[model samples]
Target chain A: MYQNPRAMPSAFQPVPALAIPQGDREGALLVAYANGDPEAAREIMAALAPRVLAQALRMLADRAEAEDVTQDAFLRLWRIAPEWRQGEAKVSTWLHRVTANLCTDRLRRRRRSVGLDEVAEPEDPAPSVAARMQGEARLRALSDALAQLPERQAQAVSLRHLEGLSNPEIAAVMEIGVEAVESLTARGKRALAALLRGRKAELGYDED
Target chain B: MTRIETGADGGRELDDLLAEARALEVVPSAALWARLAADAERERPRPRTVVPAVPPAPGGWRGWLRLLGGWPAVGGFVAATLAGIWIGAAPPTGVSSVLPSLWGEDVSVALGVDEDPLSLLEG
Candidate 1:
């Protein structure tokens, strides 16, 4: 069920769908959690928290705020577990959407009080200091560029390119139609490209 | 160095940046994981259908017997039931004599049932 990335019509192809088969497992674990199976709590965290945290971090570019969003998203999931209609929506997809929305809200609030320059670089604990600095710079540049796009566009693009979700999965996360997702991602990529055009060389991308 | 002048060039650069961003791993801290697990536990629904670790109370006669306060109560009930059945099956001499006294003559004769107009309607 994996579509070749190159064949995708969008300029920025989504990462392959190789790890997309966990939806069923996630749903089952959620049901188990709702049924009061204690171990399922840890299983749910293991299965989802990292990806959710990563998405939030990418969106907010602030570790602490991203953690808060991840926490809030999980709390919402926990509250909705008993009522969650299985097979209707994937748990991870729902979580991604919640996480994205939470990040968007925080972003809006942050925009009012703080400039994009104040958005700190997401911390990464790489072993090499130089490499870590370089990585942080690139990440910060990408995050700032993403911050410039509209919330939905940034979310769609991030889910498509950075998070590696398929177009349908992105649609599910965004609660929109597949065509809308495609359009958002296409337009998002164009906008992102334009935003990052001047910073390419500084970020180490040059004519090859 | 050629600058990104066309959409294709920018797209290529954007792809590289996205790839790098994707490669930048974002593992959750142990504290965050623990916090989420706590949230899960806090919000998890209590089991709706709890099967008793001990077997369920017996139904039917056993339940009825329990409700009646054990074998002693049941013994008294059984005794009373048998006594009533025996009395119905075979009346005592006193009971039989009393029944003739009450039924052989019209009780209206003693109680003046015939005097009452309502008694005529009843008859």
Candidate 2:
């Protein structure tokens, strides 16, 4: 018999992982596009758009602008497909770098007009309505905590933690030394924990 | 609920919190994909034109020779002129008959050897 130490209660089941396709598909499409196939470019853009947009949304905190940044990133990818050298870096990472740069620029431009408190919480009102409701408060608290960090710290934390990139990979994307990346993420995590500690109840961390 | 000691220390708690936060998923709108596709299509560089091959000239051999020699017609003219000049040059008389008497006259002028250079070739 299996010893289930942390079995989910009847009221609470774990959510399944999101099905994001592998990067190989996008790489193939990019190669096809380089070989003068426009349809391949379209396919790659369609596949990558969502992930790029999500990262942008997390970084910029404005859905509309995130969408714009995502589009711009894909556009650059399409234009550069012909010049793309294989085995240099993953296409996804390149796209991430482009999105990050655009978000950074947008953040700089909006610094005067917007405050960190104004970043709207990300929402998805599907699946179990109860889960959706539970996610809102946690998301808001986390977003606020994320907003409070310095720009580089926020970016390092976002790329490493949220985006699930390795520290070295993040360092490459951020064009920084790995040691600097570690320092940023370490500091960013400390700041995040302090920010989120008060809201532990809402985030399901303090539940019995 | 049994609280298992993960031994992650205080930093572990923060890591766990960050992990949970990262697990939150937000799928981008379908419209965003459509817009991205459109933008990609627009930004994609047009395929470069495949240049058609230039057909070799009507006289293939002549064309090849012309290409090989850079200036085929000029090369041909110079070659023909050299050939004509070589053909017009007079052939030499028999070496023995021409050079033996010349050698005898040179010996009489100076105390040279009696046997001529051309006479050495005779049997």
Candidate 3:
């Protein structure tokens, strides 16, 4: 659905979001929410959900599971609005942490029944439409490899390489030091290379 | 059999894979948004609905009396009460004669240790 960012009514008028840069959008939306602009919630829901949902999908490897994690994370952002100490942390970093923690919780629960099973192979049969997308195959392979990495390493890799978060931002989301974030991502990248090396030929990595 | 390209080795190939993942955008379905909107509405504290205090419509006797303010009305009220007490406590001869009947003869007897009606007559 096309949500006209302005079509969403606001309880109080806000400075328009037209000039908001990518990094500052969530913060702007949050400030609007705190100031009682109703539209801010909708804008935040639209802007952040896709990113959060995508991250959750990568972390959890299930669409339903990812969507649940996204919902919970946004619900929490709403709940914490009044006391959201602005500038203490970027809203995106804070949300990434929440979604990560939630995914970790579900991962733990699923682990009770699922032992050492490789999580990368897509459980769903490739629909003809999706099968045409080579990127989807690469993502599936990468996700399976990620599942094999240690939890923190997987998270570090997802945040750094996949999510494109900087090391410091990854540290904030993982609640660890920047050095640790660096170490984890480095280790994760090495591990992924070793895993994917054997499959590159099969997955058409050199179609050219 | 196909081989994935890396600038150098496997590490470069993984980097290319990571780039694909980064560029990948997964927009959530509208139903998910609807669910969130419902939860947001359910969870949002209702706006306090401040019943705008109709500014008391400018005085029913007591308010006008209050707006008239401190000294004049309040002081007059206090002074009148004090005067009434003083008159009741110690009335002059002619005033005392009429007051006893207004108060009833029992009030003089009731004044007891605080007053002696006979002593006032001597004054």
DockQ of each: 0.30, 0.17, 0.24
The TM-score obtained by model 2 is 0.56
Q: Could you tell which candidate, 1 or 3, scores higher by lDDT?
A: 1
lDDT of 2: 0.65
Model 1 agreement with the true structure over A60-119: per-residue lDDT tens digits: 667898899989999998888888777888887798888878877776676577664563
How accurate locally is residue A166 in candidate 3, as Cα lDDT from 0 to 100?
A: 78
Those runs of model 1 whose alpha carbons end farther than 4 Å from true positions after fitting are A1-23, A117-130, A201-208, B1-9, B48-123
Where does candidate 1 clash, by residue pair? none
True contacts kept of each: 0.66, 0.45, 0.46
TM-score of each: 0.64, 0.56, 0.64
The DockQ-derived docking category for candidate 2 is incorrect
Residue A104 CA error for candidate 1 (Å)?
A: 2.1
Which residue pairs clash within candidate 2?
none
TM-score of chain A, cand. 1: 0.76
What's the distance in Å from true for residue A46, model 2?
4.5
Q: Give candidate 3's root-mean-square deviation (CA, Å).
A: 10.0
* Superposition TM-score, candidate 1 onto the true structure: 0.64
Candidate 3 lDDT by residue in tens digits, A102-145: 87677666656454334344345567744545556566667667
Across A1-208, the per-residue lDDT of candidate 2 in tens digits comes to 2112133132221221122236555665676666666656555554566688778776654568888888788778877877887667778888888887787677666765656456444366665875755655555456556666787887887787777788888888888999998899788777777766655555656644
Which ranges of candidate 3 are over 4 A from the true structure?
A11-25, A31-36, A109-112, A115-138, A194-208, B1-13, B52-123
